[model samples]
Target: MEKIATREAYGRALAALGEEQPALVVLDADLSKSTKTAIFQRKFPERFFNCGVAEQNMMGVAAGLAASGKIPFCSTFAVFATGRAFDQIRQSIAYPRLNVKIAASHAGITVGEDGASHQALEDLALMRALPGMTVLVPADAVETEKAVRAALEVDGPVYLRLGRAPVPVLHGPDFIFRLGEAVCLREGKDATIIATGIMVSQALEAAQMLADEGLDVRVLDMHTIKPLDVAAVVRAALETGAIVTAEEHSIIGGLGSAVAEALGEECPVPMKRVGIKDVFGESGRPEELLEKYGLTPYHLAEAVKEVLARKQAACR
Candidate 1:
């Protein structure tokens, strides 16, 4: 029931990692306060660098630090981190496979009141497109902490997408975080809901709602966007026969697209994608934006029903 922002967890994780990993350095594009990297700056000032609103330059610096054998974590708003500094990220870090961690905060439409310009609806697609780039979208504070540590173990570039709003803590102390693996939150036979980021919690809620109507629904927390757990996706498609993917991003190339791609190649099935319908976000409260963009649990539940109907028709 407790709620905490993923950015807050990321900051705390960075500070924790700094104690154990001396080579770990943090760089921010003058937005540490918003990105929550200020926590690390406060703990280890010498290791933190403020790039002064230059996302591209920060990425370049991160690449340089990485080249020098230092694990550099670049923090900034998701929009600027991916959109403003894309070339630097691609050329400097991802192209050469530098060990730079780009922990982008305030991702997706949850960046309420910032409007479409600040919101990063396409960051996942951009990051996923990069070769050897590990993309992670943690479901909550717990997963964010684990994801930060996991990203450190990875040898190549990593894009850790985080949200601004506080979300329910989904994982417990016993939960283990593995890169490129999907966590099955709940088991069911009728259908499965694959979700990433904040939508994972919503998918669980929708699954519970469907249970009340005697519709069994499985739920998967697809935290890793790239190197997607195709095995789990294929298993879900083969067993459940239907799937509904939900995310706080565009339907084009996010969790939905990843699931669809896997299903198409391996096990084809009836599916529905619940996300922003090729539209931009607006300035409003986080909850309001979610409802307006049809990213709520109700929308996910409706999508489940629609997919279920399609699955039944396929059998007929």
Candidate 2:
């Protein structure tokens, strides 16, 4: 299995899109190297702008470019992109529904040594709250490229979350990326594991571990956080009877919250959320942070068993 960072894929995608879309421009808040937007800058210098550590100003500039009929992509660390420039994003772009792409990198605890200040655990929640803002969290390099192209097609604001660490390539050449649609990775009848971002791979691993124990588990890659495929979530709840949602974010308002909300309104069922437990991330290796925060495949498998037990109890 090959591994590649989502940010690496994003940079390659931007460079590829630049050739076809002349109106596409990129803006970075003095972190092009980390965000990987430097790839685009190298290919098309005239179209790239370095905003010099001003995330708010960069967003305003992106909004202006969009207003001028240019498709602007703002790149920066996820914490600064969503937290430091939140007001500008909300007022300048999302409020007026500007056609801008906020492609933030180094999102979630996977940021590793950057610590809690740099890690963006709530970016998804913030982006999902905005009206008409399409939020995407691609599972791997392959999906990241597909997501970048899909975000271009959307007319309104888009928030594309990316990670710093390399993850397994889950999708193949035939995989089609669709906005606001959940991809069913594996089929099972006992229960379902719904995941987004890097957690998608972990969910698949957990499902396989459960299978060895004779417990059939389905796996869903919910790449889109907003306009969340409620139909698929409802269908999973109705068929599987139990579900476990996993993500490298806070459980309050990420993939877990979204799935729980949909299940509550449509088809209620036994479920467990595996994510950051209302806390901040600490400085450590990516794998270490994941284990410490209970975001690993073992934790997801345990959550599945817990939810399965609850589902059986409900039937009794």
- Deviation of model 2 at 166, angstroms: 0.3
Clashing pairs in 1: none
lDDT agreement with native, every candidate:
0.94, 0.95
**Per-residue lDDT of candidate 1, residues 1-316 (tens digit):** 9999999999999999999999999999898898899999999999999999888999999999999999999999999999999999999999999999999999998899989999999999999999999999999999999999999999989999999999999999778999999999999999999999999999999999999999999999999999899999999999999999999999998889999999999999999988888988999999999998998989999999999999999989
Tens-place lDDT per residue, model 2, 111-195, is 9998999999999999999999999999999999999999998998999999999999999988999899999999999999999
Quote the lDDT for 155 in model 2. 91
On a 0 to 1 TM-score scale, where does candidate 1 land against the true structure?
A: 0.99
Least accurate 10 contiguous residues by lDDT in model 1: 271-280
| C-alpha TM-score for every candidate | 0.99, 0.99
